[model samples]
Target: MMGFGLSIEPQLWALLFAMVRIGAAFVAAPVFSAVSVPLPVRIALSGAIGVLVVNTAHIVAPPEIFSINTFLAVAAEALIGLALGFVLQIAFSAPMIASEVIGMGMGLGFANAVDPNSGHATPALGQFLSLLLTLLFLAVDGHLVLVDLVVRSYEVMPPGAWIAPQRLLNIAMFGGYAFLAGLLLALPVGFLLLCLNVVVGMLSRAAPALNLFAIGIPASLAMGIVAILLALPAMGDYMLVIIREALAAAPALVLG
Candidate 1:
């Protein structure tokens, strides 16, 4: 059966083919990739996005449905999608890394809980920053922006076309940026904690009879909490900037 002189079968194939990339992107993306996100929901969303792409963009179906070329095309599609999502994943990791440094500095490193995103045990502070980052991600409708990039990516690098080597280099470069960003994010609180530790050390040297653990532990914990509260506003702003910059860089890797 044909609709308006167009075969429905080919369109269905194109739709299915489109889903390969969309599905892979969802699997690798941040919020969408969380353990809390159900598999069925991911499938539905991928199908929905695939339908949108097929409707809005012109996609050609492979002449042969079963062949080596088709398998290669599938791999290319997955690669592109993973690269796109990996960019945001790198961005999200900055907060976790920052939390680890701050927690250790404040003697709160042992406080661990399962991360909702990856299901691994993360520092309590890391989890907090991760939640904050998640909120910021939604507040900016970053998911929508990422989906838009996924769609636009088809236009720039269609299925079967290889991804740019420069984009892979960009991802590697961005990993270094994540470390730098995390360090900067923790700098304020870490600095205060360092000073607190130094003072505690001096006090211990002054009074040998004083129980260093009893005094130093409490002081470090109290000071860490206070430093965090005072530095929170600035840290939040830094996260926002990181989010925006990441969003900005993501499109370049995919579209440009």
Candidate 2:
């Protein structure tokens, strides 16, 4: 019995390395990484997937479970997993950025509420947009894609593969795209509000006696809400692209 168990030690270590990457991905991925998920649950999920990876991928057995090389491979796996997770993390930032832009424009920035996902007091628009993005994320089955990508990583990079410099460059480059998408998501509402503000400024200039307070505030509020409603369909389309790009980028980030 002792010899039989010893013979499988290398296989078990390989599974351990695989779990490190998956667990790191879960810790870093957007929806899965939410503070709301208990650590024990995340670890368990990683373990389950790790078991699948070892069975399906036919990963090479580790040299020694307690050796320095095994530790290094585990660290590399974690790094790769984090890179995969960071791709989605970047994608999820778009809605938050848009929310901030629209919220500040609508004078809703001061209206703060606790975010259930993050437990932070974000502006009202941020909360609304977060909810919308969350819905869109689930609607597109992005969560499944995230899981699939991590699983695919085991096949592509496997354990003990060298991390390439270009992959790190790609991760950095992806951040630029994330910021651009965030701006694009926010642009419609932000621009419309800017136009509204200009009109309000003109009104204030033309008639100093006009109760700009009474007139402009309600006007901006109504316009902001209308703009958001008008932008909804486009926002959904934007999210579709964002999720696709994020999922596609995951394998590159993890494997490279």
Candidate 3:
């Protein structure tokens, strides 16, 4: 007669640590971290991917888990995961920022709705642009690319790898690009609205008793919508580039 029992191995510990990183990443990532997605589903996905990573990659387990060094290693892993996800978050936010600018310029700032992702009241234009970006993100399989980057990170950076301060600074600098991209996206519509405002001001000065508010508001709104529609194709193109750059940068940040 023989009895069999299960024992936890070093590889199992490595898998668990890997799952911690993956789960942290999903928690900070855009689509996967959406409020609509159940927490359990996110955990399952992290665990599944962690299993795949452990099976495919040669992950080195820390000699001890209940020690100061292991704690620091775990912290490092979580930071790497969070950095990877945060880069994508910054890229995704560019559309929302552009929408906000355009919405304000169009005199539609008052038309606010609850944002599905943030659960906060945002201008309707911002919501619309965010939705478009989200759809485009899916269409291009950006999520798959993100997952691939995270998976590849293990091989490139490995567990317990220390990220340098210069790399962190670079990540912060990368976020600045989002603001520039957003400004560029809104520039066409914003410029048109500015021109409309100037023209409206001139007309109001020429006719002292005329109601310019009624005319200016509608004109700006109409022109803004048209500008956005016309610029959409270009916006898509720019967003695709941003997404690609963000994905490409993840490995560098992690490996650093």
lDDT of 1: 0.88
Question: So what's the TM-score on candidate 1?
Answer: 0.95
Per-model root-mean-square deviation over C-alphas: 1.9, 1.9, 2.0
| Residue-level lDDT tens digits of model 3 in 46-112 | 9899999999988887888799988998999898888889888888888878988888888887899
TM-score of each: 0.95, 0.91, 0.92
Q: In model 2, which regions exceed 4 Å deviation?
A: 253-256
A best-first ranking of the candidates according to their lDDT comes to 1, 3, 2
What's the lDDT for candidate 3? Answer: 0.84
Model 1 / residue 181 / CA error / Å: 1.2
Please list all clashing residue pairs in model 2, or write none if there are none: none
Query: Which residues of candidate 1, in runs, are more than 4 Å off?
Result: 1-6
Q: On residues 25-115, what C-alpha lDDT tens digit does candidate 2 reach at each position? A: 9988988888888999998999999899988996875667788887787788888888889888887888877787788888777788888
Model-by-model lDDT, in order? 0.88, 0.83, 0.84
Of the candidates shown, which would achieve the greatest TM-score relative to the real structure?
Answer: 1
Backbone N/Cα/C clashes per model: 0, 0, 0
